[model samples]
Target chain A: MSKLSKKQKWLVAGLLAVALCFGISPVTGAMHIMEGYLPMGFCILWYVISIPFVVWGFIQLKKSIDANRRNMAIIAMCGAFIFIISSLKIPSVTGSCSHMTGTGLGALLFGPAAVSVLSVIVLLFQAILLAHGGLTTLGANTFSMGIAGPFLSFGIYMLGKKFNFNKKVTVFVACFLGDLFTYCVTALQLALAYPSELGGYSASFVKFLGVFAPTQIPLAIIEGILSVIVIIALESYAKPEMRSLGFIEQEA
Target chain B: MVIHWLWVLPFVLLLIGGLIYKAYRHRGEHHHHHGFGHKHGEATIAVDTYAYHSGIAHWNPAFKVVLSIVLLLFCVISDSVEVSLIIICFTTFVTVVLGDLSFHHYFEMLTIPLVFLIVGSVIILINFSWTPMTNVILCLPVFNFFVIITHDSLYVTVHLWARAFGALSAMYMMSLSTMSNEIFSVLRKAHVPALLIELMNMIYRNIFIMADTQNRMRNAAESRLGYVDYRTSLKSFGSTISNLFIVSLKRSGHLFDAMEARCYDGELLFLETEKPLNAKLILMALGVVAYCVLVWVMTRGV
Candidate 1:
């Protein structure tokens, strides 16, 4: 077998990290697409949709490990990072609080494919151990927060970097937008399952968006700031580690 | 308008806060057994601790999973709330009897999802509209609106809630009785690809180590008054988190070294515990299937 390239390795590591995050303790995110929230058919459909992505993630992971065993620790670290950082709850607003997904940072650092898998692991553990997310709706949750959020974050980050935006500003915007869009995707998912009589899917989506806005807007801002600060802190304090993880090039 | 939107917040938050408080107290009370991870999450202990028992714990993981999943499916697929509610009662009885867990503790754990079901049901109950419809549950002054709960909506809400409760009960039965690793073995048995399983095991092992590291770091920061105010808290949180990431990367490096020293193959290996099948096991399996049938029969037409 041929050795995988650096980009391939990251892709592999991210997929493996999904399985890794699945192993984390179940101190989960609050009120995730909880169990039984979606109907039976919806749940099954979601599992079907998500399982392919999850399997692809693991396949990528196996290839990575077979190519190089040392990548195991890197995979573990990314998984741990997803678990702990996303678990951190900053006060979202007044009455309610939402957790920073840590997806923005993970996506920017790891790529969306890896983050997609990692998010599933995080959501799975959240559903199982913490009882925050639902086991049945894992697919829908994975699609929304896992696949969608990271893709947006990665997309935005790439675009910003390509446009020669300041690294710090790019990180902030990516994280902020990533956080906002996670809720947006979540709203869409929820609406899809339970469309309102008032306006059907679009209206229900808007309603969920409205409901999430008060909390998620503050959360987006908090998450954005947090990601930027973390990036800066790592760049300043752990330059070598960042370089090791390929999160940064050779230190300035 | 504001009152209707915001009313559920206090209620939900209070329930959540109470859960946290209870977990905190329970952790302090039982810290000797759990060590540091209890503070971060008590549900880990509360729900999973019973799985170690030898009662139904000795049963086949695949069979147990099938049984639970079937029950869960019934709960969801069934049209009758009566059937779902009956399922809730049945699973509750089995879980308590077979698992030998406290009824109070079991019910307490169940309440969190019950609360979620209530909050989610609210969305089903109300839609923003000017016209008042039949079966209005509450005519609130919010958005010049009333909660229009017709018979059909009521039936759906109650049915969904019951299904949720029933499915949860079924889940509790499986989770409470089977060790997590056993569940992993079931995944393995189901031929869920070796790479994913190994990776999951690796990550699962690492969760404890990360928790230990994070717990120590958090304590150190707390001692330094890192969370004294909101602003300081954010700054401190940012630094601590980044520090943890750096530390995690380093830890993984060390872990890789250790694995290499152990002649680490990528494969994770664990011996599955074996228990001889007996009539009791058969009876339990039969009883569960029978119980399921009985449930459908009793509440089918309702």
Candidate 2:
């Protein structure tokens, strides 16, 4: 509802820094890790990890629905936002073609919980109807694009505001890092699934990371910039609604 | 030197070409959901359209989903390329012959996954390492390491490629035959979380509404030279997104009021022109399962 205190800022920044260092990167094979790429066991493991988060999100969703009837529609609108943005062919970063995750703005507006729900659904749609992501690997994809990225995004936004950073720059950083971190988590997922026998997990991880850098790096940067533009535009165009959503605070 | 390594070269070149084409074509050309002729999201729109016209459109959507999943399981469990090949052929026959998709359009749709499989398998087949590889069919020196390919790797790659292609084809069959609304209804019937199903239904309906709103904003911006340059394009796109978010939020509020006016109590219900179970289709699905089992039995150790 309001700005965070200094201690809260430090806590968020610390948490984000740790997340950035660890819960890192995604690679492109369509919008997600793709289906049949990971083993059944790994997929199950990721799904198990994701269940708690999705349950928490589901609870939040039910609460929203119970609180206001319009919240359901608004949540659906957020889902549409995720679908349209992730599916759109954005400006190429490096040489690899990729799509923006569309998680940042929603994470900033609706919180990470809502984005988590939105992203899994979006990924599900991509997998089933569009044949992009696969059903088996849904959990891994969701963790990377949905949970990891959104948490990074929401963290960056909070820290940026607490540090008195410019809103434009803050949006850009939140989105850019959000994209980068999503793929980082993805690369980890892949490397874990298919570790390099010679070099073990670390080597495979680096290789996956190296493979994605040319495109993912540039893609994340552009995502950041685009998110900044989108957030700024929303500030002007949907000021009242955004304020109501608590993305913007009540006017003094 | 193993000649099998040569198998990946043509696919490699094709991939390079696709990448170059992708990099150069920057103007939001086309994709799954939004683009006019977008290459990827076509499955979503195509499936919905085809379901309406599909000969087996009257077939139960849930049955089709189960049928595809079964076929997909068969594809996944088998390691033999022959089994995957069979699965793909069977899936194609079902989609084209039974599901009623045009062969031409079907093949066009096949290219995406086929190419993706080839590209992914190529990378999977290659081992990049600091030390030179032994027993390699072909090796290429890169920056400071070697890209090694071997006969076994090639065999495995082919198997994996086939498996992915087969599994995807099975999904295509289901999607091509099942409508989105029908799929949602099936999910609802299965008791797969009422809140999620409801949200998805609304989102699915609103996607088009938002897309229209976005298109209008883009056109209005373009008419006034809002996208003449990179910076302008960025600005135009940004404002359009913000405006869409704003409009969707406001519209949702209005929509809620409108629904409430009509005595809408949160749950949005619609008619699902339900179809009775077709014995022929059910038998055919069972035949598919039997074929899969036959493949598994025949190719147990391959």
Candidate 3:
């Protein structure tokens, strides 16, 4: 049964384009608000509460690895790979730059569970070495981009499949929405943390939404196109290898 | 409003107590397992999975669905700083105590935000002019005796700092404990659109892939003595970034191709786990609702 119909393909593509238009084409991406901008007591409260969930996730990951040791090894290696990759910085328009976070790729390859584990590892290393994010806020960051991003992408992909859309269009839509959702969730998180300085709910939300729309939208689109291109290339040249890796199932 | 030192002290004590408890518990557990030599075997994974299943199994997914919506609503409706700070701190404290994390771990987590708070407050105080009354209260000798609590400047400083720390810590804990997958699951259960979730998933996956590629390229360049000097480092770094982008672009292309061949029709299949609503979940939801309502009532005139 085809997952996406022809009409669905176009719809997915259009949605992806829209998401890209709002997520990545602007400078607002640079204003990553730090912890303590909001109320301290609240920040501590949330950090404490999030522990069990994180522990639960860790437990789930451990189980998955135990069941499939090879997959576990692959995930660990990928986690290490992700750590290495995020260390390299890419220059943005401003003098300052942002590095690539390969969480998206991890999700595509191993699903969100594996990606979450990889993200936790990368986040830990980043906190200890680069001081990009605080140890206290690690749970928050992981939940925001790590856990939220992959599932969003996967859910979009599943929805597209239901409609029987074309493969290229499906991938594009999934990538775009995934990127957009991450930014949206991130904005929501920031808004929750610093609603006052951010100008309260309505104003802060609109501002936050407006800020990331440009940068993340285009970034999402670029991400979509890039993903599509890579998938198409792999289909033609590395199909067998990809299949062996369980990235793509062979048609009956 | 005249700030009462006594009122603030209890809140501080509660916060400190929570942190210490988490640290102690975590240490205790670590010690208890030390005799096992940190068993890196498959059993660890099994234990982890068991914990995840048990934890999630206890919750009613439907309750989470409702809670998320209500939480989002609270985020929108509660505009008062005092109210928000109260909510943040209370929730954080409750979560910490409930989660069984240790005091040391909690404190370690606070270290970064505390430093930032101190530095930022000093900067803000320096930049802003204060009223005479504020200055007098802030400069009170007695206030300085209790970790620098004062009326004017000190009061503002402590209030702002506490507010900031409380808010960040609350949100941080929530995000940390909640799995991204669970968030998506909650959304899905709540009937959020599938396409939105799929896109989020893809972006999540690719971020790491791109990061990895960039790191490798930088290392390769570094090994070749590419970053020996400042000028060379800049040049090398620039080229490396460009190269990374190109490579990322190429990799995305490959992923698309792979997806296409797999009959990917713009949709991803997710295995739905069974999550039934129960009385416990209902109770939890009711508790949150009641708390929110109470906050609303108390802060109505504000």
Compose the digit string of candidate 2's lDDT tens values, residues B203-226.
Answer: 887776776677677779889999
Query: For model 3, how does the per-residue alpha-carbon lDDT over A90-184 read when each residue is reduced to its tens digit?
Result: 33443233334455655666567667756765674454323345444566667665777777877777777778889789877877777677778
Candidate 1 residue pairs in clash (backbone atoms < 3 Å): A35-A134, B1-B142
- For candidate 1, the per-residue lDDT at B224 reads 96
State each model's C-alpha RMSD to the native. 13.2, 12.0, 17.4
Tell me the tens digit of each residue's lDDT in model 1 across B1-302. Answer: 33332322433454445455555545645333323132333345455666776357877777777777777777777644655655565566556655555556667667656666666666666566666554455433233444345555566677777777777787777877777787788888889777666656666666666767776877798899987777877888888788888887888888888877877777666788885556776686576556556655654543
Give TM-score values for chain A, per-prediction: 0.82, 0.86, 0.73
Ranking, TM-score, top scorer first = 2, 1, 3
For model 3 chain A, where is the 10-residue window of minimal lDDT? A23-32
Error of 3 at A101 (Å): 14
Reference-based TM-score of each model: 0.82, 0.85, 0.46
> Relative to the unseen true structure, what is the C-alpha lDDT of residue A48 in candidate 3, on a scale of 0 to 100?
62
Measured with C-alpha atoms, the lDDT of residue B224 in candidate 2 is: 99
Interface RMSD of each: 13.5, 11.7, 17.5
DockQ sort, best first:
2, 1, 3
Q: Best DockQ goes to which candidate?
A: 2
True contacts kept of each: 0.44, 0.48, 0.07
